[model samples]
Target chain A: MAVLNEKMIENTSLNRKDILWMKIIKQRQLLVLCVPFMIFVLIFNYFPIWGWIMAFQKFVPGKGIFGSEFVGLANFKEAFTDANFINAIRNTLLTSVLKISTSFVSAILLALMLNEVRARLFKRIVQTISYLPYFISWVVAVSIVYMALSPSSGIVNEMLVAMGIIKSPIAFLGEGKYFYGVVAFSNVWKNVGWNAIIYLAAMTGIDPEIYESAIMDGAGRIRRILSVTLPSIMPTIKLMLILNLGNLMNVGFEQVYLLSNPSNIDASRTIDVYIYTYALRSGRLSYGTAIGIFNSTVAITLINICNYISKKIDGYGIF
Target chain B: MEKKRSHDMLSKIGYRRMTAEDLFLDLFIYISLLSLCVITLYPFINTIAYSFNDAIDSVSGGIYLWPREFTLRNYEKILVGNKAISQALFISISRTITGGVLGVFATLCVAYVLSRRDFVFRKVFTPFLVFTMYFSGGLIPTFILMRDLHLINTFWVYILPTMVGAYNIMFMRSYIEGIPDSFTEAAKIDGASEYRILFTIIFPLSLPVVATITLFVAVHQWNAWFDTMIYNGMNPKLSTLQYELQKLLTSALSIAATDTDATLASGDSQKAAVTPMSIRTAMTVISVTPILFVYPFLQKYFIKGLTLGGVKG
Candidate 1:
């Protein structure tokens, strides 16, 4: 680590600016500072890069990525044809879309509703409590889900029965059809409050005078909110949307991994889980890498396209 | 107009206060808010109850509000079985603490350097870090990298891989930016080395974000079972509590949850079988309690850390 830092400054001096080497040497102090972090990124982030080559090779455990014989395009071919791989790509896209939309709309609606609170003390309490679930790990959160949706004795089923919806219980975790909805709803529930945190910060940036002036003009609360509040937070919303678009193919691996079952296999097979199954679980190194590469390619393209479109439409991009 | 307005206000204050408009809105808001709060907290509460309840109650019927049949037997069962749980806890806690410390220090160092206005290479390295955030070496190479470094099944593998967080580094750097650079420059004039300037001056001033990042990293370590799942999945002893419980409970939920005594080896040939529900419940409570205890203490600083970090980083 020290070696890495020293190297950043050894060639550059603190006084020189014209030479790139001198610039580094000149800020030898700061360059030295970047050493440990750079080494870490090198060791952790860069080291694994060799594995991407595995996508083109036929990787075996003992032989590893380097030792494995190159089997060009075989894994990619397999991934394209493999129903599981194709389904995973589709499901991942679907879930990310659902989460982005639900989280976007719900968080705004929830925040708007929250802003109406006259009681400061009450609003603070509500804000804190709502954000608590986002902290729980998937393992803990899923258990709560299991308890709430347990077929014979889940609280949700119990309530549904009491309300005369169904005489029998619905097996939430045991079905394939409800998998998307379950993943989407649980994700929205976990994230809506947390994601709203950003918008809330943005909302504070809105001028109070806008609201006051609207009231002065005898505009009702609804009209002022539609015209002013939404317009003010539009930049934040668009920025968030673009960022969300960037990870369109990377819906979570943990929660879906936790909730997935043989029965729900059709609905819950996302690319992350699929990658885990192939690379981590089954030890199909090349195949997993190929799938991951494909997924990321699609995600990156989608993000770039979205960024361009948004830049054209609204002249804003996170980049 | 002033007299009429004052009289209107006087009349409004006569009862409890308000023109009846504020009162109903307050009730509507409070009720709506209370229900949402219930939705938020209800799941966490149920899991706690499930952890403590008897094994049979978990699978048999519904349990809400409280355990169907209270029992400490399940906890005993898991404890008595594979001494792996105890070892996993110790391993995970130490790994997180040690790893978190190193990651924070390294990240702070990088962030500090980048925060300097005079650093020319900051721009060069900034994009490098962001680029890595967007892309990762596919799994095959990463595994190979770990293998080459002899990181397999070693503690350094965990600590070293996480030694830098560009996101956190960005946050810390931006935060350090807020600190006046004159202090560091003055320290330099006083003949303090760069190391001293970092430790004595910059680090002390960075307590708030540092504390917040600590919570973030610590929580990350606690919540993350994936590392253990990937690196040491085969080594049951090295598996953290979260991963161990996840594996055992998810596969054979009841088998891991049953009481040891209930399934105790008989004088003959019979062996033990864990009761699934109780064991899962016990594991959930055990794993989550320490972290949950930690949240409220760091809540204030941690909350600010995320929002502020998000904006600047």
Candidate 2:
């Protein structure tokens, strides 16, 4: 709870210097270092901000930002009433819960298993192979999943058929019912290993002395893990959960966009996809921005709320 | 006599150290880890094999953990059919290396500046940068701004828009400030210019976080496709590897999945099909090759760099 910079931190105490070069130099090096960052910020970040007014106006490219007619909050009101907006919100919240839970459980289970392995060589190979899928682009990853799940001749359907389970192959990606499942499962497969990396990183930091002490007390492996390993990684677990909850709205557009079909659109249209469709297809820039602004506002507010609660409850958050 | 006695003692200790229960725990751990690895690695290996195996073999449910026909035709499909992807690879590679290297340099400079308490604007700049993270002009505004600047479909759009990010800057800053100030003062007193001090002293010492951010930015640039899709639409040449890979997925698979023509001819030796599964797999391999290659150099950072400048949990 202590404020690291509480005193308004006069922020000084550099060594005194000569008159000729150092007089004018008042840390000129610092200024020089900052110039490029300043330029990047101004051009990419700040300039684009001026276009926020497009949300208010009709947003004609020919009319320009300044020249457009002010429609006020009409775009927002329309977005509010839209069925697609409602569905998008519901879909976003639902899928995000599925995604985070699936990923969180699988990664922890994986880390627990990985930690207990005694054969160092086998453990290393397993860890490396598991994490390989993490590095591939989601765009490409969707393809792999699509191929494996395709209705006519996918390995999954083939195995199911060979086992005489189903009379017909299920169109896993094409229909409304199965699309969400596929999305969440694909997320788990791609991220579980990568997510385990953090927990693994956290676990290695646990003191070896604890294990020795646990052994002395006749504590077994599971007991030692539950008592020592789990507790040690709890801080990371809490921090990551809070951060995940905050950014829960941001389902990647690439995956849904690539995988979704007209039949599955009703199920898979998250907020990002909704806004993308509105903007790209309808050319309703104002309406799209209104939706984007609404989505982002919720995202930002949630993140802040998470940060505040994390700090208040556990005394940890990424400030 | 002492050695024989010690061996007896070690055997006694070993006998006492582990029981059937301990062996069960070890066995359980090994089983779980192995299963987890299979679940994780299966899809990746399947795709890799599918890319090499004939498209017919793959689509027909033959390809799984290993290749069937062992043909390079899928790789050939991508390189031969699309000149756009080939061009995009060169562009992305140059941008990643140059942009990545320059990003590190610029980040180092800013981080150093921010690290110094003497820098008056350090406090002023910190939140200003962080503010952008939480809020941005939505896609429309950003697109309009890009159009206004005429950065659309240009090489500069790829490089300049995300040249230096605030978190990365903060990461480097926190790291640089963690270094002792005395080193910088000592270098300064020896009449080393600021640039010289940076290159010689600060950079060498700051390698851990620098390496960390380098991987972050490089991977980010490599994985980026949304920007290409939105900003450089219709410009096939500007399509990054990710973009090209996406096109292969959607255009090839999404469209082909529906058309009965491909399905009807599915059994044929028809080169007419162009093999959606194979192309997708091939593009996946191609897109991932750079990450796999650079991975060896940067993999150490996954643990070392992360923990060294680790944020307080």
Candidate 3:
């Protein structure tokens, strides 16, 4: 009786394995469709992780990644102690904070103002014009910025001088003192309309009956906006805040790289620009990789923290 | 009944006389919004005016909404005199078209496969792709990988790494999932293969999403200069328009920073007709014109796409 029971158990286990294999065979076409892309993802996304090991080694270009000397934490040590890297970190955090706050507040304000507009044609025109800058390349946008900020011929300096606000024209992009403001202003200018779209969508989902009840309670326009509109879009506001927080380390590499010069390098060099300069330009491969690792680590940690907070508050996370 | 009630409420609200406070608020909103429009538009208008004005004449610096001395020399200099700019334009156009098409197709295939509930690997592949959205191998490793693959200084660098994005895939998959399974099942019963169903049915039905993704991918490819700056900087033959503009702008900016007087006074007598400022403005206009042309028609679609992604995300 014991032997019979054991044989039956073995037979059932083998049958289960056979059924699994048969199911895979039945979906062979689907496998063929998916496996190539899986391989593509592995090559482009996952395979490069093996090269991250070079951060530990003193990477020599001609010698290849495998043929490098393994130095323990030396590259990271060099990075943390370097003054420029430290400055880059400071600039990165400061600029990111400025950008997040300015862009966030302006977008919400623009959306609220637009929501109050009763004229459809005027609203559409303003919205369309506002989105134009967002679509253009930063190269082109920077060109416009340079032209507008030029001390000699720029419209901004011209207007200021015309108003007798200053004795001489100021080179807005030529000083470190104005770099953060310029970055933040240009960021808000470019993205305010595009960013407001999400908020506007959220506002549309608000119930009209709530507004009616508020009106019945003798609520004024300001009171209606404050109590009804703001609270209604609270979830969206939270989601956007969390999303922005996750990207606190990424301070627009293209904008900073284009904007940075000898004068403003003190304020403009973020970690991305720093990594590019060291890793690719100067060919400090291992050290650059170590810095890159530092950036990715912080970014991932921020994202995970934000995700955790979001899940705790909203019962859902972006990931 | 609901519509009638809302209409009645709106009418009642409309009947209420505008209070002085409401009038003041309305005026404030309108004035602020109009000024915002002016601020957004003034830079582009100034650029256009400068591009049209003669290089030397623009140096006097009173041009605002209109060109002080109009000429076509800046445009002629860029289009006819410069061989590099024209070649870069060609490279930019080709890459935008190729990248846009391939990106959309790859995104569709992945989304379709993932959308299939019965596909055994759907559970595995979805997470595999989505995990990339949160983390990456960072810049150095990716650069080394591209170098090893011999993609440096090649056109393929622009297309391959960006062809299939996790976000695009997720967006497209959610879109495809909205299609009824009955359609695919019926096609299967009629002996249609997966490819046939995708092309004949899914492709036709998913045109809106396809258009949205195509515009997104194309704009990204068009605007991308960093890739060219990094991977193909040495090869002028593969330089993109945006990168060319970047090179011009950087040189102009550096020169402007060091010697403001030299830039205004540096143009030679023979080619003094074209200055760095004029050429820069002309290039900016050229680069931005294509986007402006398509912006109005495609604006609604992208707004919808963003809202959809935001909701699902």
Candidate 4:
């Protein structure tokens, strides 16, 4: 009886295996479609994680990752002690804070102003023109900024001098004091229109009856906006804020890199640019990898913390 | 009649008579908006004016909305007089088209597979793909991987790393899932394979999203100079228009700095035959013209795409 029971159990397990195999065979076309992408993702996305091991090693290009000496947390220690890295962290946080706050407020304000516009053609034209900068490359945008701020010939300087706002043209990009402000202003100029789309979308979902009731209550346009529209879009505002806060670490490598000249290099070198300058440019591969790891860790932790807070408040997380 | 109805509706909604305060508010809002438009547009107009002004003449400053010394010389120098600019332009266009096409097709394939609710592995693959959106292996690792794959300094470096984006895939999948399953079900019932349904039915249906993704990827590729700077910095043959523009801008700024210093020393200003300002402005125009050409289509679809993604988020 025991032998018969054991054989029957074995036969049932084999039958379950057969079922799974049959399902895979029947869905072979789908499998064929998926496997290549899976492989691509594995190679491009997953395989890079293997290189993170270098963060713990004294990695050398000649010897490669495998032959590199095992240094453990020394590289990470070096990163923490490095003055440039610390300064980079400060710049990254400072610029990111400035950028996030300014862009957020400007985008919302622009949307509110746009929502108040009565002329559809005027609104459409303004919106279209605003989005123009967002689409162009930072290279082109920076070039435009350079020309517009050029002390010798830029319209900005010319206008300022003409208006007697200053005795002479100021080199906005040539000073460290103006770096963060210029970065923040340029960010708002590029993204304010694009960013406003979300708030505008949130506003569209506001019930018209709410506005009608406010108007009936003797609410002026400003009061109606303050009470009806703002409250209605509060959730969206929170979500956008949380999302932006989550990305506090990534202060846009390309924008800062392009904007940095020798004059502003001290203020503009964020962690991302630091990694590039050290690892790729100067060939300190392992130390760069260590800093990169630190940056990623902080970013992921921030995202999770934000995600948790969002879930607590909204009952749904971004994930 | 329509205007009358709208007026009636407005009144019914308690539209008050325009008080002096209301008129003042209206004027404030309109003027603010008008100024915003000017601030946004004045830069481009100024750049265009500089590009068209004579090279030496632009050095004297004060060109605002229109060219003071109207000449085609700047455009001529960029479009015809220079070999490097043309080569960079060619490379930029080629990469944009190739990368855009391949990226769309790859994203669609992955999206279609994940959109299939009946597919047994959809649950597994969806999360696996979406996780990539939140985390990455960072820069150095990605650069090392490119080197290992022999993609460094090659044109393929531009195409491959960006071929399959998680955000685009998710966007495409959400769009694909919106299409009724009945169509694909009917195709399957007719003994049509998944490939057939994807090509004959899904691709045609997903053209709007396709155009949207194509624009996103193409613009990204066109605007990308960092990749060229990192991966192909050594190879002039593979230099993109944006990268070339970057090179030009750097040299121009340095030269302008020294030129000013020289003037300061001598207490007299001298104009070069062709200033770095003119070349930089001309290159800027050349790079931006293609984007402006496609701006209308971009404006139409990108808003739709943004709202769609916004809803999903």
Give the C-alpha miss distance for residue A134 in model 4, angstroms. 1.1
Give Cα-based local distance difference scores for all models.
Answer: 0.74, 0.76, 0.87, 0.85
Instruction: Indicate whether candidate 1 or candidate 2 has the larger TM-score.
Output: 2
- Candidate order by decreasing lDDT: 3, 4, 2, 1
lDDT (10s digit) by residue, model 3, range B1-313:
7744784675469448577767887899999999999989999999999899888777778889999888999999889989999999999999999999888888888888899888877878998999898778888899999999999989999999988888888988888998998878888998887888888999999988888888889999999999999999999999999999999888877754544523554555645468777888898999999999987888888888788877776
Give the residue spans of candidate 1 off by over 4 A: A1-26, A64-67, A313-316, B1-28, B56-62, B79-82, B252-274, B309-313
User: What is the Å distance of residue B276 in model 3 from its true position?
Assistant: 1.0
Steric clash pairs (candidate 4): none
Which 10 successive residues of model 4 chain A have the least lDDT summed? A204-213
RMSD of each: 6.7, 6.0, 2.1, 3.0
Identify the candidate with maximal lDDT: 3
True contacts kept of each: 0.53, 0.58, 0.63, 0.60
Model 2 / residue B45 / CA error / Å: 2.7
lDDT of 1 by residue, A16-100 (tens): 4447676666667766777756877988897676568888987787886567799889888887789887788778888888877
Error of 4 at B293 (Å): 1.7
Point out where model 2 deviates above 4 Å: A1-25, A162-167, B1-21, B56-59, B252-261, B264-273, B309-311
Model 2 Cα lDDT, one tens digit per residue, A41-104: 8888888767777788888889898788999999888887999899999988888888888888
Worst 10 residues of 4 chain B by lDDT: B256-265
In order, the first chain's TM-score in every candidate is: 0.90, 0.89, 0.94, 0.94
lDDT of 2 at A268: 87
Ten contiguous residues minimizing lDDT sum, candidate 3 chain B? B256-265
Candidate 4 stretches greater than 4 Å from native: A1-16, B1-16, B253-272
